[model samples]
Target: MSERVIGGHVAGLITVGAADALWAGLTVGSAVPSASAVFTGSPTLARGGYVLLGRRVVAAVKASGGAWSVPEMEVRRAAAELGAVGMDCRDLVRIGPFGSAPAPHPVHDEGTLLRWRERIARELQKPGGPERAPRDGGHRLSHLAGVDWRQILVERPRMGMAGSWWLPRTVVRLLDTAEHTETQWLHTARTRRIDNAVIEPPPHDGQAQAADAWRTTSQNLPTAPLRPYSGELQGLVYSVVSRKPGISRKVARWACAVCGTAPAAVLDHCHEHGYVRAPVCQSCNTQERPDHLYSNDIRVAGHYTRLFDTDAAVWLRHWHRCPGCRARATLPLPHLAAWTAHVACRTQRPTHREARSSRGRKPCGALRVSWTGGHHAPHTCVLTVVVDFCPSGEHRVLAHVPYREAAEQFRTWLAETVPAVAAVAGPDRIDDLPTHFRPVIADTSSEGQALF
Candidate 1:
């Protein structure tokens, strides 16, 4: 064949092959080359090359059966090609729809083009690029670059000192107000003082006259001095002190009447009768004297006597026996007193129905005993006590018994019931107990028993 005919045949085959490949890659399969590739290449050759390259990439992706989606694969292939060819795909922005002019062209210089291509490839490979395939291929490729296009297009005003030069009047006023408010806050915080007059110093000799004047103004008129106590008065004082079992005349004299701490340096007395009521520490004496003078009158003393008598009767009846097993138990004295007071109050203020109901039904003699593994098995056996009462019930904890005491009680009970087990090993031999009884026996020991 002639050279002219051969050249023409070759060109025709190239055109036909390009058209077929473009149709198959863009329409038949999922993969499609980016518009940037088209814009960067020579109009005839570049378009054919991209179309053919896209076809090959789609085929390879399908053959490999990669996990990557169609768009990801296309992007990877395009980036690799652009990087290898030293072509700036970003220069596509200077062409077509992205540029101001119609029908934009590629840059002429090779070095500049190569640098731009490198930058474009780097941007394309970044994490923030378009991850999913766009529905409208033409618009997405031409308009939305991998980078935020809005930031590039929109003009932002220069800020800080440079912005102050040409800022509008309203903006300047707002800024000034904000600055002033911030300045005032800082100044107030820096200068603020905290008053903490926690300790008082001894008065100087110069201030002795002033202090004396103040004390004189504040002091109440002195009452007649207490007369020598008769035998009857002494008996009355003893009776009142003995009512509260834990308190005695000696203890009352040493401890503060109000808080029950610190040495009792001041003797608090009834101003009207000139009778000493109780000894109190200096702080309590100063703070509570006026209130006590009114509240601790003859009538209040009579009420206290009645309360003590009722509490004494209740204590005699129930303080010696455990309600659960009818066992002789040593009740905590303070707890017994408190419980007696509660029962007395309840009985004094029973409703009409409650009074009638109480006559028929047996009275509630239930007592609560709680045991906890204090230091042993703290996480696992936090509360080992067999709680008999509802936790949410309106009942006060009478006393907190030590874990060791509760454990000893459990050991004694075990010794009595399972004498055979006690015979085989001693009462203290908690490890010799049956597997099922181990948890129960363990509860009675200061040191926890191992399960295994």
Candidate 2:
């Protein structure tokens, strides 16, 4: 067979064997050779001067157990004489249902697809072309190329500027020679260095700015002053300091009276001004005055009830009288004096003088003495005894316990004494203290004292 070319270049190669020649000749195109005509010269040339005859023959042979078509008969035929049953002459010569048009091929595997993609990318590497994305539509290849070019530029050459504040030589060169006046777009489009370019100054310092902020705050508040601000308030303060007319002065006297307690560990003045506006010890201005005996009794009971884990009602009920009893016992002019004297006696009892007296036989002739009836009897006589040392006819004697039992019995005696008033007053007595015993002093001036 001679060399065949179409459109000025070799299109396909040809060979002659029984099956190949048959297949080639049976092609329907007008340019094709007939099967019988080609096979007619085959047997004669089998051993003749055929240089490279083996290769040509091998190419001409069909593969084993394969099938082909015979166009002359228009039917499928077996490759009987060929070394193999069929040969894919698809590359060499086109012969199929749609003659010169090739059959569709199978889809490429991943590796082949990737290889084709890389080839496409390399071919597209030159500037102007339609841009193509990766398998998943990522511009990965373009990004990689950009990054590689950036790395090369960064590592390869250093461009310097002329003046102190001049742009870098690379930037100046790129700007001077750029195709468009929009140099920023050109820089972003062409070079990867745009990402690293400096655009603006550094951010402001928030902390330092905050530190320089203007601020305002109030100070030196004048708390409670010695005198109130307005005239009305001043008058009010004066009024409170001074007692009103026709009021009893017992409260005033009691308020001003300095408690005779020692160490001065009690309030002696009222705190009417300053941050702490309450009664305080005059010395320290911090402690409260020791309260009245009656007030202190209530306070102590209350304190014990609150702080000592005792039932307050039970504790209070033990010592406190109903109002009527308290009034009846402690009120009335005579009762007042008696109560005062009783308290005085209790206060002075520790220092009271005791007078000795004889027990058994009184004086007769000489003093008759008896020592457990060993007979010198002391004489007995009726004599007037001086009692609580009242002048003349008002003498009264009272019995007292021996010193050994006094302190121990005092609590019982006190308990007994307290209930006596309540029992005497009975249940239906009036609540307020009797008017006569309620001390009344002249309220002539407000120079001192208040708080009955």
Candidate 3:
């Protein structure tokens, strides 16, 4: 009943199932609390039931992910890091283009981790689990799009639709087809451009499993026949990725930067670095990504601007509105404001190869904050910021206005840029500081600088 993914015949492999893929991939459009779960794809879960859940919880705690290294955590990471840059981890770390979160197994607390295991076990334990799809409205459900119910039995499960039948993408989308969110969940829209080579990779068929568990594996995968693209949209996508200094085909997706809902045919290159910011639809992409068409970028979108919350960090919900109200329309992405602003800031950053210049640059990007330990003298705590961020080895000192103003500015930008900054739960040892939080200021405590 171990959730270790390894068994008698599968010592070096993990037999992936549809549940693993779905739990690993079904991205919720809204971000308030993006639902996430880690799928072990162990064949034991079929009959493991509550026992599987209990075991996984203990194992998760033992992993001590950030602090201690456990085999469970190290295996996948080693498996991923060892197999050419992006192959082995594709199925396991299905985030961003070919990466996300560095390691995908650390996003759980004990309670959530237990529930994640329990959910999958019970879903599989259900009688005729594969056939019994989740309900939509009242009985007799007829048609369901985005799902090939027939193939759930025949085909192997892959990412995206590899979900529990109760909450497969088809079921979730079908149920929320009327969903229109005018709200915020700030996870950025990332690309998962899986090519033919990745579709039926090794994880899809690593080893055999119990017939019953294996049959239920792809229950969430509702797949249909493949359809080749030959439309204007395809041409638009090709044109966007084809242009030099435009979006590289690796991570460029057809999602817009303004309202993430549309097909982004226009590739918006950063005004400064000549790097792609976001691929916007005809309705989005503010920068002259294209000429003939009129585009509404996120900063100036009249109606779209009103959809954001007070912080302007995320979108607002359109669940409740008066008659004839279009509040339910999902215009820009859940993280449009932050993403646009982040991209806007990145525009100031010159690529590593480019020489630095200060024609018209915001001070925030160059600002580096250094703080003294306040534990000894809380009242005498001092925070200092320096203009030290430069690709070329050059540091500039600056006299900041007020301490509070500088701190807030740096904190906000740090959250968007570093992202992992807020998660710094004080390093146990000074040597273990998070990369960005590492002490960079010169050791000026004893007056003159000393040679190392």
Tell me, by TM-score, which candidate is best: 3
The true-versus-predicted C-alpha distance at residue 238 of model 2, in Å, is 14
List candidate 2 stretches off by more than 4 Å: 1-218, 227-343, 346-451
Evaluation by TM-score, superior candidate among 2 and 3: 3
Model 3 alpha-carbon drift over 4 Å, by segment: 1-44, 49-367, 373-379, 400-452
Better of 1 and 3 by lDDT: 1
The C-alpha local distance difference test score for the whole of candidate 2 amounts to: 0.21
Q: Worst lDDT window (10 residues) for model 2?
A: 214-223
Worst 10 residues of 3 by lDDT: 181-190
Whole-model lDDT per candidate: 0.26, 0.21, 0.25
Across 257-367, the per-residue lDDT of candidate 1 in tens digits comes to: 434434343344322222244444433332221111111110011122322343333222222111211121222222222223333223432222234465554323323
The positional error of residue 252 in candidate 2, measured at the CA in angstroms, is: 18
Residues 1-452 of candidate 2 have per-residue lDDT tens digits of 21121121111212233324443433323111122322223222212111011101111111122211112111112112212212221212100011122222333211011111222234234354224333243323322100111111111111251111111222212211111112222223223224534221123333222111101000111111121111121112223433445322212111111211111111121112101111211211111111122211111111221211223222122212224223222221111212222332233322222235444432111101111110011132111111332323343422222222232242234345444433443333443422222232211121112221
